[model samples]
Structure formats: structure tokens, C-alpha cells
Target: MLQTEFPFTLPCGYVDARGNLHRQGTMRLATALDEIEPLQDARVRANEAYLTILVLSRVVTRLGDLHPVDVRVIEGLFSADLAYLQRLYVQINEVGTTLFETQCPRCGLRFSLDLTEGGDINDASAGL
Candidate 1:
């Protein structure tokens, strides 16, 4: 099982047409589950970080007019968000049940096992 954590905070600001800065209360951001899964995969951690930056770039594009500092802040927040998502997937897998397919070491016969909600092993074809 993998355990991870991430923290994030939104900043207050937006750029004006005259290149002036204005103070704002909060910013709205959309997060997707699919976008965060690769981040959870240990083999692709570096790639995940790069993908997160791409997603942040899309957010900045949507904002239309944001100062460079604001973009940096947003990037930090998105990174934290990705980490949080990774932690969530780990917790879910820890509690959820899974079915396993196995082969007999003696005869090479394939068999399936079902894991109950409580993690007990049972023959997958018992009810069939």
C-alpha cells in the first residue's frame, strides 16, 4: 500500500487590462480523477509531475489574464491537489476487495479467487 499527502491554498488576484494587479477573494478550479491516477503510479512519478504542470497551464489559459506570480501560486496549489488525489487512491485500494487469478503450482491449473468485503478468500465460481 502507498501513502501520500498534499496541501494546497488558493491565492487572491487577477490582472487588469492596464497591466495593474487587483485583489480577489478566491479562484475556482476543476479537478479530474483521471488526471491524478498516473501520479499515483510509482513507475511514472516524474511523468505525472510533468502532466500536472500541463493541466495547470490549461487553468492559466482559462484565466486569460494572470500575473506570473499568480501562475506560480496556481502551480503550487495544483501540485498539492495531485498529491492529495494520490493519497485518496491509496486509501481506497487499501479497503476495497479484489479478485485474483492464480495457477496451481502442481498442475498449472488456473483458478480464480474472490475476496469478500472483509478480505476473506472464496472460490470465485462457487455461485455459478
Candidate 2:
């Protein structure tokens, strides 16, 4: 079965009006409508960058104690958290998996690296 939702922890997290920090969240795979509807949103029409906010709001089903996360919540997120989610969105939707296959040149050993842990292919020391 295809995985439709992915869980994540924000690096900086969202701080609610009550001053509570929400770090954990779940983002479901976006539907065609999820991508299309946002394009028609006035906010996105005004500022193309706002598309990220709308798209994220629709796909994120839960966040910490919050359910049905919305644009207001996504807008309140720290920049780091927004960036984190954007990368995650691309990783899961575009790349299709967090596990990256790589090989050790010397030993010819193959291994899978978890991209969610901030792994970088350019950083040779990664996963060592």
C-alpha cells in the first residue's frame, strides 16, 4: 500500500497564543485539488510565495494538540519550521522516500540514509 501521510517534528516549532510549543505534526500526501485550489487563492495570487502556506495548511492534518491545522497556524510558524516542512514536502512527494541509497567507495558497502535526520549527500562524513 502507498503511504499517504508522513509525520514530522519541526526544528523550531509553532508557538500558539497560549505560548505552547507544537513541534510534532502529520502531513498527508497532497491531492491534485490541494495543489490546484491554492493557485486560485487570493493570497497566493497576490504573492506566489504564499502558495507554500496554503498548500501546507491543507496537507497538514494534525499538529501537536491541534487538529485540522489551517493557514493561520501555518502563517504563525517560525521560518525554520516553514523551511523544514517545505523540504519535507518535496522529499516525500517529489523524491517519494526519506531513505536514500548510497555506497561506500572503499568497501563497496551499500546503505540507506535517512534524509529526515538532516543528512546531506555532499557531506561525506554523513551517516558515518
| Residues 1-128 of candidate 1: C-alpha lDDT, one tens digit per residue | 42222121222333454665433221223246535654565544656446544544333322333433243544544344445333323333444524443445577444444544565454434641
TM-score of 2: 0.77
101, model 1: CA deviation in Å? 43
Report lDDT per candidate. Answer: 0.39, 0.81
| Model 2, span 1-128: residue lDDT tens | 77788777776789999999998789898888989998998888899999999999999999999999989999999999899788777766885466534455577554546666576454324543
State model 2's lDDT: 0.81
Every model's TM-score: 0.22, 0.77
Please identify model 2 stretches exceeding 4 Å from their true place: 95-128
